[model samples]
Target: MKKIAILLALSVALSAPAWAATKAVTLSISGMTCGVCPITVRTALQRVPGVEKVGIDEAKKQVTITYDYSKTNVQALTRATKDAGYPSSIKQGERDHG
Candidate 1:
């Protein structure tokens, strides 16, 4: 029973990170009509909990965000942008970033 308990504890510890993993993805944003638009979008994404990094491409109307999956998800991201008056969507087929 002691060995079994030890193995179970080890397994739980190893799997914890996977459960709260980080994910990065590119989001297509709309309503960015000028140079200052990226700043607004960036602020919106940054306010989300677990958001680590934000990269904005005004020309492409896209923003890439890295965040902890356990704290936030794509829905939260989109909602933040929308609430900030810039609606966004996840770009299809764009895999998670490093």
Candidate 2:
């Protein structure tokens, strides 16, 4: 009976799809020198289907976004930012110096 229960549990676990991973991405944004810039970025990013959260740092000219990889990607996020008129790109590993 124990062996059967363990097998059933293992089968159930293996049948379930693993949850997607979330990644933190920083984007360099241009034309965000004013207060509205952050708002614009936040609104745009939130519209994305998989974006979990967004944070914009005006002083650093960076926008941090948390998203599920399966639903969205960096390229799509960057394009969304650009479409909002902020014009953004991935910050790579570190914050932008500009």
Candidate 1, residues 1-98, lDDT tens digits: the string is: 99999999999999987677788989988688899889988988898998989999888899999999888888899999999899888887776664
**Cα RMSDs, all models:** 3.9, 5.0
Native-to-model Cα distance after best TM-score fit, residue 59 in candidate 2, in Å:
0.7
**Candidate no. 2 TM-score:** 0.74
Predicted structure with the largest lDDT when compared to the true one: 1
Lowest-lDDT window of 10 residues in candidate 2? 89-98
Error of 2 at 42 (Å): 0.6
lDDT of each: 0.88, 0.83
Tens digit of per-residue lDDT, candidate 2, span 3-98: 999999998899754555777788988679988889988999999988888887889898888888778888889889889998887786764221
Instruction: In model 1, state the lDDT of residue 40.
Output: 85
The parts of candidate 2 lying over 4 Å away from their true place are 1-18, 92-98
